[model samples]
Target: MRVTIFNYGAGNLFSIQAALRKEGAKPSVTKTGSGMKEADALILPGVGSFDQAANSLPMEEIREVIRSGKPTLGICLGLQLFFGGSEEGRAKGLSLLKGRVRRLPPSVKVPQIGWNTLNVERENELVSGLDKEPWVYYVNSYYPETDGKWVVATSDYGVRFPCLVAEKNFYGTQFHPEKSGATGRTILQNFLKAAKK
Candidate 1:
């Protein structure tokens, strides 16, 4: 499938693209509306601040892609971008998912960088064939709080926080599955499978 990766000046796109290639999926990087419209599925990978990331490209096509009900996945700041707003900046988000991104509780380290075990919640397509409590790489200060039961996974830094979320055709992960080794690639594979479904 033509899986498009959003390249809005805020993500580790190369690694994600490479991972998609490994999964035998045709992936392309784009930052324009038309480029987004041509894709069967999309991946929004984020590694920068929420405000800068969202404000970089306020493309309506990207928003519509999420609303179109086709499979869409967000990683790290990409996950935070699904919220109505973020604590990192004043810029509003696409609001595809019901929630707000806020600073990870101060009880933990500031960046919350490094590997952490993921607590899988429900049996969703994103983690359908993966093991529970898989260790994934994370690097963020803000976390998403969805109003509904969208939470798919949780992780502990200083306190437990939502590590992954899935709602209908929408999916998000706070951890960088592309950087999390074998299990990480497996997570991407799970996403690819979901997209195919």
Candidate 2:
């Protein structure tokens, strides 16, 4: 499968590309959203702050493509971009879903780096074979505060927040699947399978 990873200039591309390759995917990187509509799947990788990444490319055009039902996966900051805006920046998000990205409560550290457990709250193809409470790698401070209708799974820090969400063909992971080991690989493989259909 041909998968395009849209670079937000500060994107973490290598690890994700390697992960995609392991899943039998032909992964390529693009700084802009050019030709992304042609790919079997698209990824907005987890890296960088909100404003810088949002401004690095034409998100408006990219948003249209994603809404067109092109299979999409967003990780960390990439997932935050699915919301309308974020407390992290003045720039707007794609607004594909109704919500905002907010920082973790003061009770927790600024950046929640390390492995956290995924509390599967709902069923979806993304978490198909994951443990009920699988541990996944995370390197993030902000989390998406959205409706339950869009949330497929959640994780707890100072508060329980959406960790996995699916809306039509768009999916987002608050944790970095590329670094989450075998469990992460399963999630990506599921996405590829769904995209192939």
Candidate 3:
């Protein structure tokens, strides 16, 4: 399948593109969110901050496309942008899902880098073959705060927050699947498999 990744300025394109290619996907990167409809799937990488990423691109088109169920995968900051807004900045998010991004509480270390366990809350295609407690890599200080309806799995830092979310064709991972080793590959494979059908 052809997967298009919307790069929000320096949006870790290499690693994600590599991941996609390893899964036998024809992946391409676009900075302007151009030619999204032509691809079988879309991706929003975990790169810049909320304000920088959202303001740089034409969000209206991207927002509607994902909402239309184009089979999307969002990572880290990419996941945060799915919400309505963020405490990270004044810029508004895609609001594809109703919620807000908030800074991680001071109790735990900020920028929860390295591997963290994913506690599966329910079964979903994104986490279809994942181990019960998969340790995924994360590098962020902010997280999405939203209704539990979309959340399929969660992880605890300073607080328990959604680690994997799936609503309609939109799937988001607060942790980086590309950086999560074998478990990550399975998740990506599942997404590609689902998009094919």
Q: What is model 1's C-alpha RMSD?
A: 1.6
Report how far off residue 45 is in candidate 2 (Å): 0.4
What is candidate 2's TM-score against the reference?
0.97
lDDT (tens digit, per residue) of candidate 1 on 71-175:
888998888888889878898898887778878787778888899898887777777667655889988888887656888888887767788899888789999
Ranking of all predicted structures according to TM-score, beginning with the best and ending with the worst: 2, 3, 1
Global lDDT of each candidate: 0.81, 0.89, 0.88
Q: List the residue pairs that clash in candidate 1.
A: none
Worst 10 residues of 2 by lDDT: 4-13
lDDT of 2 by residue, 65-139 (tens): 998889999999989999989999999889999889999999998799999999887778888987766889999
What lDDT score is found at residue 188 in candidate 2?
89
**Tens digit per residue, CA lDDT, model 3, 94-186:** 888877899999998888888989898887887777776788999999998877778988899999998889998888999999999999999
Kindly report which residue stretches of model 3 are placed more than 4 angstroms away from their true locations once superposed.
none
Report the Cα lDDT for candidate 2. 0.89
Which ranges in model 2 have alpha carbons more than 4 Å from their true place?
none
